[model samples]
Target: MKCALVLCSLSFLYSQICHSANIVAFMPSPFYSHQIAFKPLWLALAKRGHKITLIQPNVIVENNENITHIVLNGTYDILDKYNHVHSLVEGQSVMKVLYAALEAVMEGLEYQLTHPGVQELLKGEKKVDLFFTEFLLTFGFSLGRSLNAPMIGVVSMDTTIEGHMSAGNPTHPVMYPDRDMPYPLPLTLKERMLNTLHWLVDRVMNEIFLNLQDRVASKCLGQQIPLNDIIKNVSLVFINANPLFNVVRPLGPKTVNIGGGVHLMEPQPLPTELQDYLDNARNGVIYFSLGSTISSKHLSNTTKEVILKTFSQLPHDILWKFDEEIVSKPKNMKIMRWTPQQDLLRHKNIKLFITQGGLQSVEEAIFNYVPMIVLPFFGDQHNNAEKMVARGFGLTLDHNKLDVRTFRSAILEVINNPKYRERTKESADLVMDQPMSGLEKAVWWTEYVLRHGQTDHFRNTLSDIPWYQFLLLDVILCFLVITVIVAYVSFKLLQLLKCLAYKLYGKLTRKIKTKIN
Candidate 1:
């Protein structure tokens, strides 16, 4: 009996070990916001006994032996030198913004790929079971291929045309505008044309980036890898989007929506002083922050003055996350370099969230059931703010056009109306109504890829079809040519029949005349 029990125990331990995998999450993108979404997945995977080697600019999740970090300290520094977020506040063209972003990331990622630690990862003969990489950063695909392992692409925003192609999904530029575009749904004919043009431009720019990816990645690994091979290795894509948060569109089987996980699913404990402030507010509280990338203190002098003046007159207590200290502060206002945003939003007395419409921030607002007055500055913020208005949960404002009257009126409009909060709560219900939380689902799918070796079935045929064939231009041309040929033959046949009839009529007339004579 003792021998049989020992054998069963040993077998169970073996099965557990088999399930655990050595995962290399090559998320070298230097954005701090991206880290918020990725941290949960890393920790969850670690809890399951999966060993993770995270190659990022900094260590987000610490104190875990299961997860290791390959910290490249100055990656974001290289990106910041090129990032045009400040220029975007003044309203630049979409093409300019897109190109600037590509340049920033391309340069930043190049710096990361050249790092000694990252190079070691590329050359090391470590046992890698699966690879997780940012879908936008295509270079990681090379590393995945070098290790002969399947790759999962992670998108932290609305899936771009490039991201769609990577996951084998359809791209509907006409029906759905790019995330950066502020056009509301039911686009005009001219708008559709512009959207298509933008789509094509982005596609072309991505190709340029891809060529660089191929060259740089080849140099790093000392192997000649073609772009086609880098593209084919993507086994799955986890897009950080949900039906409620982003426009509902068709997604490939391998592409999964795992949004709302970036924000804290459960509210954290508020600090004593902050908690007292929120609890003591008799009227209400307004929480304001420009998110992580764009600081509130960096606003233009005129814009900042207008905001502060407007806040002084508002009836509710205000909390602003300003990076710098102010000389003259309003009695009802509190300025903190960093406020517990998630926790503050959870307070019952918090009436509104003044924000700069980031994906994670928007999700946080939706999940917390807080209506917002969104002041959009850059990339996807415009569209995200417009969507918030379309849903009746928020209103958008141009930060450049900030006046005391405009800012004051916009805040009052949202607060005075109960419809916004009502709609927001309804949205919260939708965001929360899931079979599994997005985090659980993400971890489940990640392990699913590890367990199942071959998943080529997930790719759609639409992905493999060429652009010309996808539009059915060849079929349409063939049918048009056949129709023209048939029409020409029918016309000639009619002419011949008409001539024969006329000849017969003339002959009959002559025969009748001859008989009469």
Candidate 2:
């Protein structure tokens, strides 16, 4: 009897200590930057004794007993796709380029969905307590329905205009321009009108895409489920943007801004050679990287020559993340295929960051108090660059119109300017002043959802209301109708009064004539 009681106690203790929840995340974007942005959240959860099944195009972290990685092959190469897209959409409107980029992402998602591991998950053999995916690919929400689990969205960049709308966040187009439009806040009348039109176009395009996604997901899931319904049921969203980098807007309770989420951790030590170079730089150093998606080798030869020649003229030593070897590299420039970007930014000697304005890169620059010279290529980079300029911490230049003189001058201006550094430090302080680190907030909210098992209390009811109703068009129409009816009645009453007075005057005139006779 004593042995049996001891065994029962051990069993109960084991159960209590191992109450693990199952979480599945699908991040199929081909960009390493996106993976980096999402890594911290997953790692934190995994460390907390949860079972994670991650479906990604690349394996960012190694799998252990609790973490399972489902690697998807044949994913779209972002650089090749970008090059092809630019060739096809050259001289086209920004909207055209935006649509092309989204299409490329959809293609990647489709490939991921058809993978064997994803198919096995969709089979629903294992119970999933939660599902997480990037927000831009709305079809990924279908996984929630497939597993009958709550869904969470992760935005690698600032929440898109449509994303804000989906989460029932307040979006003033004038105040919060879409990521594609780089106009500063408090826009002019023309800019506001254009921003409004951009929102409308984005809505229409999103509807069309959602329909396509629904159809594709239905085929993949072997059942018909509306994409809108899936989006409406999302329990939470983790947006990788902070208020420091974004306009002031109201977010729904379900929408958690984990801006600087990726920057919460201490950076890894730099390689010995790189550390030596930075340690020995007496005249300060400038770090230039166009990010992972856009390679320096893919740039035009003329552009490359201009950049190199301009860098050679600068007083500061240059560290360029170039993909290939240059035949005649400048003496002051060091080229590497990959660099510990975050680690390098932490160095005191690093003065300025010349970048393509990718969101992650911008956040790193701000977190490290390094001002920027932004040469945007496409998408949110333009908007980020504009914000940097608006915030007085950076300067923007057109990559296509870049000349040696302009490039060199822009660098000098940022380096020579005191205001940029001061503003950058101020912004960095604001970004880091959060009560809790972004990763901690994300994990806490995620666990909150897990513990509650339902987040209907947090969901915004505005998501269910039609756009027309949400905008109060119905109320406006009712007021207009009431005004028109009241105005018509008052006009008729005045006409009737005027006729009665005229008749009275006519009667008085008749009486006066009769009396005179």
Top TM-score hit: 2
TM-score of 2: 0.90
lDDT of 1 by residue, 1-517 (tens): 9999999999877654437799988887676677666787888899989999998887888899899888877876766675577557656787887777777766776677788877787678777899988887778778778778888888787677877766677777777666666576688998888988887788787778788778777776654877655675578888887566565677778888887645464667899999999999999999999988887766888898999999999999998899987888889898899876777788899999999988888877877889999998866788888888988987989888889998999999999899999999998897788788878778878877887764788866666676667657799999999999999999999999999999999999999999999
Question: Candidate 2, clashing residue pairs?
Answer: none
Candidate 1 lDDT trough over 10 residues, lowest sum: 259-268
TM agreement with the true structure for every prediction: 0.89, 0.90
CA deviation > 4 Å runs, candidate 1:
1-18, 90-99, 173-202, 262-265, 494-517
lDDT of each: 0.80, 0.81
The residue-level lDDT of candidate 2 at 183 comes to 72
Every candidate's CA RMSD: 3.5, 4.4
Instruction: List model 2 lDDT by residue over 1-517, tens digit each.
Output: 9999999999877644535689999886677788778777888888899999988877877856778999875675643565544443244576666676667766766677888888888775778998888898778888767888888989887777778877878766677777677676678899999998998788888898888787778767764868887787789888876666677677889898877645445678889999999999889999999998777776777788899899999888999998888889899999889988888999999989999898889888888889999988766788888888989988999877789998998899999898999998997897787688888888888887787776888878777777677657899999999999999999999999999999999999999999999
